[model samples]
Target: MNLKVSKEAAEWYKNEMDLKQGDYIQYYVQLYGGIPTVHPNYSLGVSIGKAENIAIKDVVEGITFYFNSDDAWFLEEFDMEVVFEKEELEFIFHKK
Candidate 1:
């Protein structure tokens, strides 16, 4: 599925979060809307529904990319609050 990410996001993951190509970065949407505590890593805060996990695939500007649907359940139902793992950077990862 095609996911949309901001240039800011890509850079944040790379520079601050040490993300690189082929990294399996995790993206989850806030099912509801609310403000999260500020952090140096997430200075812009978070955007709900900003990252969507789709069932198909493609790449384009204004889109974020996910590895694949191998773990779709975590995104769709199981791991709803994956965003809260930011402190440990546990929810996201690079393929390597």
Candidate 2:
């Protein structure tokens, strides 16, 4: 799997999350409550935390954004991109 983050999206995260250089942004599969794309009844979640085992990652504006190994199954068949649009962060998935 692959991960990408747009510069605009990265900037948005840095400001909204009050992040600094070297901070980590984690992406994981959330069981509920978000718009589903790749999975039925499931969605992605984001948080500021350290990664135990990085599966896929992207660095932008000095921040590290990644998905831990445990979430690999959720992303294994797709390449994910994060972008800033409509004043919000949007996830785009490309099936691999």
Candidate 1, superposed: residue stretches over 4 Å from native: 28-64, 67-96
Residues 1-96, model 2: lDDT tens digits? 899999999999999999999999998888777646679888888899794698789999999999898887887888989999999888899998
Off by over 4 Å in 2: none
Query: What tens-digit string does per-residue lDDT give for candidate 1 at 1-89?
Result: 12344444455555665545544444333333332312222211232122345453223233334533543433332222222234433
What lDDT score is found at residue 35 in candidate 1?
29
Q: lDDT, candidate 2, residue 85? A: 95
CA lDDT of 12 in candidate 1? 54
Please report the candidate that would top lDDT against the real structure. Answer: 2
Per-prediction TM-score, please?
A: 0.32, 0.93
**Model 1 TM:** 0.32
Say which candidate scores most in TM-score. Answer: 2
